[model samples]
Target: MATIAPIEYFDEADFDPFVIDDDVFGEIEDPYAIFDRARANGPVQPGTILELLGAPADSIVAGIPQFRVIGHAEVQAVMRNAALFSNDVLKMNLGVTFGDTISAMNPPKHTQVRGLFQSTFMPKQVAKWSETLVDPVVNDLIGRFIGDGRAELVEQFAKRYPFEIIYRQLGLPQRDVQTFHRLAVTLTFNSDYIRYGKEASRKLGVYFQNLLEERRRNPADDLVSLLGQLGGDNGLSDETIVSFFRGLINAAGDTTYRATGCMLMALLENPEQLEAVRQDRSLVPLVLEETLRWNGPIIFTQRMVMQDTELGGVRMPAGAIVNVSMAAANNDPAVHENPRKFDLFRGTKSHFGFGLGPHMCLGQHLARLEMSRALNAILDRLPGLRFDPDMPKPTVKGGLMRTPRDIHVLFDPS
Candidate 1:
C-alpha cells in the first residue's frame, strides 16, 4: 500500500495576533454599547456595523455587504422569512466556495439536504455522544493540563476539544486536526483573513474529495459514510456532498470552540456566577444558555433581500444586504429582563446564538453536549479555578464572531 502523505500544518506562529487590529471590529471591550445605540434608532438599522470599524460603506468584508439589523423581533422576522431574505449571501460573494451548503440553500433544497443528517444530531444521538465521546475528550484534555496548576484554556483546552470530536466524527485522520483548526479560524474570524481562508478552502476541498472516494468504496459508521450513501434518491449531488462536509467541518469546529471560550470568560468575569455553577452542577446548562445570549459565537449573519420589502418600518430594495445581529437580539430589553446582565438564573428564553428558523444550526445539540461536559469536567478536575491575577485578564474581541482572545487561569493544584 502507498503511504498516505501527511497533511501540511499551518504554523500558528506565522500569524501575529498583534498585527490584527482590535479596532478591526470596533471597541471589543463593549460592543453592546454600539448595539444599544443601533437598537435605539429602530429595529432595522441601515448601514453595516463595519463602518464603525472604518470600512467603506460599500466594501465587502468576508463577502458580506454593508447592512445591520439589531431589533430582536426584526432579527427574528428576517431569520423566519427565509424566502424574502435569502441566506445565499455567502454564495453570492464567495462564488462556489461553499457550493450548495444548507446555510446558503433555500426552501425545498435546504429541507432535503438538511434532512439527510438530521437524525445524526437528534437528542438521543447527542446524548450517546456526550457519554461516549464528549466526556472522554473533555476529561483527557483537562487531565493533560490539570497538574500544571496554570494554563491558557483557549490554546490548551477549548480550541482542541471540539476539533478532535468533529474530526473523529467525520472519520478524518487525526493528523489533520491542526490544519483544520487553522483553516476554520481563518474562514470564520475576519475578512482580512480571506486570502488564507480561500487557501484553506482549496486544501479542504482536495482533502474531502479523497475522503469521499474512500468512503464510497469502503463505507463506515461515520458522517462521511452516511453522506456517501445518500446517493441520487436523496437529491444530494457529489458536489453538494463535498460542500456539505466542508460546511459541517467549518461550523462544527469553529463555533463550539469560541462558544466554550466565551462561556468560560463569562464565568471568570463573574466569579460569583462561576462559584454558583461550580457548587451547583445543574446550573451548567443555564450558564451555557446565558453565555449564548450574552456573548454568542456568531455576532451576526447576513441575509440578502430577495424582493423589495419593508422591515422594521424601513424600506429595503431587492438585493440589499441585511445584517441580522444575533448578539443584539439576545440583549433586546423587550424580551430579556436586564438583558445586559449575565444571570444564570434568568431561566429559559429564546436566543439566536445557534441561529433561528430553517437554517438554524444543525450541530447545536452536539455543541450543547460538548460545552456542558467540558465545563462540568473543568470544575470537577480543577477546583478553585480563577483567573491568574499575575497574568493579563482576557477580554472578548471581534465584531463578527466574538470570543475571549485568551483565557489565562490558575487552579488549585491539589
Candidate 2:
C-alpha cells in the first residue's frame, strides 16, 4: 500500500541498532526507539509502533523486535485504530489461550460474545455481589491478621485472593478452587507453555472442556454455567465457552494479584498518601484510580495489522504488529500534568486498565469492585500499615500477561 510493505522485515544486521538512545531497562526492551526518536525530533514526525506478536512476542530477549515502549499521541493512535490494528492476537497467541469469544474478536463477533458476560459483570451485579459476598470475603481475609499486625499478603492472600473470588462468582465448586488456581498459575507463570504453544493450547482446551461439561450437567447458578447456556448462541462454541472460562480464570488472576501487589507497594513507598487515605478512607477511589495509572496492571497489549495502514503518520502494512503502551501513554507529559507524580485526587476516571473501544475488558467492574473492597479493608483495618524497607521488591514476569510474583508487606496488623 505504501512505498514498501509496512510490515517490512529488516534483517537483524540491516538496520542500525543505534536509531535511538540506549535503554538497558531489560535484556530486550522497546523503548519504540523510532517512535520515541520521532517524538523527540518534533511535534509530529515519523515513527513505528512495535507489537510483540506470535511466538516472537513470547521471547523476552535482547535483539528481539521490541522497538520501543511508546506513549503520547502516537500510542493513543494505536489504541484508537482498532480496525486496521486488531485485538485479534488471540488467534495468534491468546486465541490458543483464551479460546474464541475474547478481546481478540472484532466488531460483530466481539459484540455478540462479549454480551454473554456483560450481565454478569454489570456494575449493578458487581455492587450486589460485593456487599453480599465480596466485601465479607475480603474483610475475613484481612481480619485474620488484624491483631497479629503482620501478614504475608501476597502469598497468603493476594495471589489466591482473586482466584477464590472468581470461583465463587463463576459458581465453581469450592473444593476445585485450588485446581483452578494452579491452572491459572500455569497459564500465567509457566513460561514453558508459552514456548510450546500447541501443548499449552491443548492442555487449556482439555481442562476447560472437562470443566464446561461439569458446569453444564450441574447447571449451577454461576458465571460459567450461564456461559454454558449461552453456548453457540452467537458462534459461542463449546470450545469458546471453555476458553472463556479459562480466559476469565487467567485474565484477572494475575492482573489483580499484581495490581493489588503494586498498589500495596506504591502505598508503602508513599507513606503520606497511605496516611491520607487511612485518615479519610474515602480517598480509596482516587488512590485506586491513580494506582491504575501509576503502576497499571497491564503495561502493553499487541495488535496485528490486517491491511496496510498509516500509524503515527507512518505507513504500516498488512501483517504488521503494533504494541500499544498504556503505561507510557498514561505517563505522557503532554496529556497528564506532572505525569510522573501520583495525585490521588487527579479526578480522571478513565484509563487503559480496561482498554478502549469494543474490545474493552469484560471483567472490569468485578476487578474494580475487588480492588476497592481490598483497599477499603486494608486502609480501615491496618492504619499503621506501611512498606517495610527490608521487604523484598516485587517482581513481575512478562509475556502476553504481566504481573508480580511476590509483594511482601511488613506492617503492624492492627
Per-candidate TM vs. native? 0.92, 0.80
Best by lDDT: 1
Q: Which window of 10 residues has the lowest lDDT sum in candidate 2?
A: 17-26
Q: Which pairs clash in model 1?
A: none
Quick one: best TM-score, which candidate?
A: 1
Tens-digit lDDT track of model 1 for 1-414:
013355454445486322453533434566777777767678776688655433433344344334688888999999999899987676753434555567788887788778986887899888877766778788889888888899999988887899888887877666767766666555443455555556666677777777777777887878788778876776678778877777777777767888999899889999998998889998988988899998887767788998888988988888888878888899888899888888889884689988999989898898888899899899889998999999999888876666777899999875
For residue 180, what is the lDDT in candidate 2?
53
Compared to the true structure, candidate 1 yields what TM-score? 0.92
On the 0 to 100 scale, the lDDT of residue 12 in model 1 is 50
lDDT of candidate model 2 versus the reference? 0.62
How far does residue 64 in candidate 2 sit from its true spot (Å)?
12
